[model samples]
Target: MLITSGNSMIQSLADTAFAYGRREGDHDTSIPDLTLHIRNTPTEPLHCIYTLSLSLILQGSKQVAIDDRLRICSAGQSMLTTFDLPVISHVTEATRYHPFIGLVLKLDYGLIAQTCTELNLERPSKDLRYQAISTQDIDTGLCDAMSRLLGLHLTPEYIESLAQLYKKEIVIRLLHGSHGMHLRHLASVGSPSRQIVQIVAWMKQNFAQAIGINELADKAHMSASAFRQHFKALTGSSPLQYLKHLRLQEARDQMLLNGLDASQASGVVGYESPSQFSREYSRLFGLPPQKDIQRLRQA
Candidate 1:
């Protein structure tokens, strides 16, 4: 008997994910392809870099603010992003009885390309409204495929073999969803969005180094002004601004996770002056580096 899509089934999947990885921080399970997220209470807005991924909200709701635009997504809705985005997200609704449960599957561009070839799917037209991050309703077919993917946890024997099949099906179902056009544009070779995606990937890796508009434009094969326009359109931030956020976030992680001091972290993240780093860190995080770290530790 196949697992069918229903409220009860979705709830059960959420429960399983929660049980498997119920920590204050993010949880990764034996399933290499997915990450299960559970938040027991409402949280302050968190700023992070969102990769090209699909996030399914199984049990609660959250609000995501990208640039100046805000979107609220609830249970049964999916948040799809085609490229890296800097976002501020908060879990607006959650409680012990009904905790916020979600699953994030990082989309594999290579696998998407393979599926596009196999299905003979043409690249869709670009929509200026598609800002890389968009929300869509979760269709019954997609929910069913995700249920089966989560169900693999119950049967260890088939997990290794059957997980791949369910993952492919989920991607195919996404191709048929409301954000299909944007997804197609992302997977399409030579599309402007795809070109920016490559540039973003490079920027992420070399964020600590100085990068210029002309260099990035050349990488995307676009004129300087056109590259800036397309980059902001797709990522909602100027290229240099995007790099700043990435560096700041990484510095925060260094301080919080790696136990680095402010000056050390600032130097490591490419700041020429520690004072400049402190000011910017305070601007973004609402406190000085040491104070923020202390607050987080106390919390």
Candidate 2:
């Protein structure tokens, strides 16, 4: 009998990930396409970029808040984020004995487009983006596919030969699941959703540069009013709001990773005034930039 709801597969996958991860943070797996995330204790909310990816919880749970919208996902559940979103997220439930473990696969747009063409799938309409960030119970088939993907770690030699195939299988499974429509919309070209994605990519690459709504609207091939509406629909934030978050997040990273002072970081991320940067940083991070970096470093 095929096991659809059994915990054995999920548990084994967790064990494998834990054995490899061993430490208490995110780890890129031996398989280039997968990332292993482990947490031993509950955490404070953190701001980070969530890429277009599928995250499967193998043990414990997580709480993800995007644009103040919250979703809690636990073992046996999968969370799909279809865009690179600025999110506040943390592990809400974990322990040394049963650490929170997740296997995250970054979605490959090219592979998805190829699969859709091979399957003769049509693009989903723009309405699908409203449900882009979703959580649902992992179906048996998906769990089984994930188990197989994880097994490749045991035989490193097979990674080059089989990882891509398994990843493709996983994508195919996702395309048939509840969040399939969202993924389909993302892969289709010339749609409003695709235009939003293009605009988002441009913003990501050029967050430090000044941008105007009119320019963004033109890039999206929509009128200013329509662009504002569709941008919010796709990202849950207006274009400027999204750009603000992107700049602030990058500023934080600069402080944390590059050891830049708040003033320096602010200027680097295109904030014209240090005082304004501090205020916005405190508003988003719940602490001033200096203190937040100090706390982060100590932790």
lDDT winner: 2
Candidate 1 is scored at a TM of: 0.93
Q: TM-score for each prediction?
A: 0.93, 0.94
lDDT of 2 at 105: 89
Q: Using TM-score as the measure, which candidate wins?
A: 2
Clashes of each: 0, 0
Model 2, 178-271: lDDT tens digits are 7788888888877677788888999999998988999999988899999999888777788999999999999999999999999999999898
lDDT, candidate 1, at 217: 97
**What is the lDDT, from 0 to 100, of the residue 8 in candidate 2?**
82
lDDT of 1 at 174: 82
lDDT of 1 by residue, 192-259 (tens): 88899889889888888977899999999999999999899888889988989999999999999999
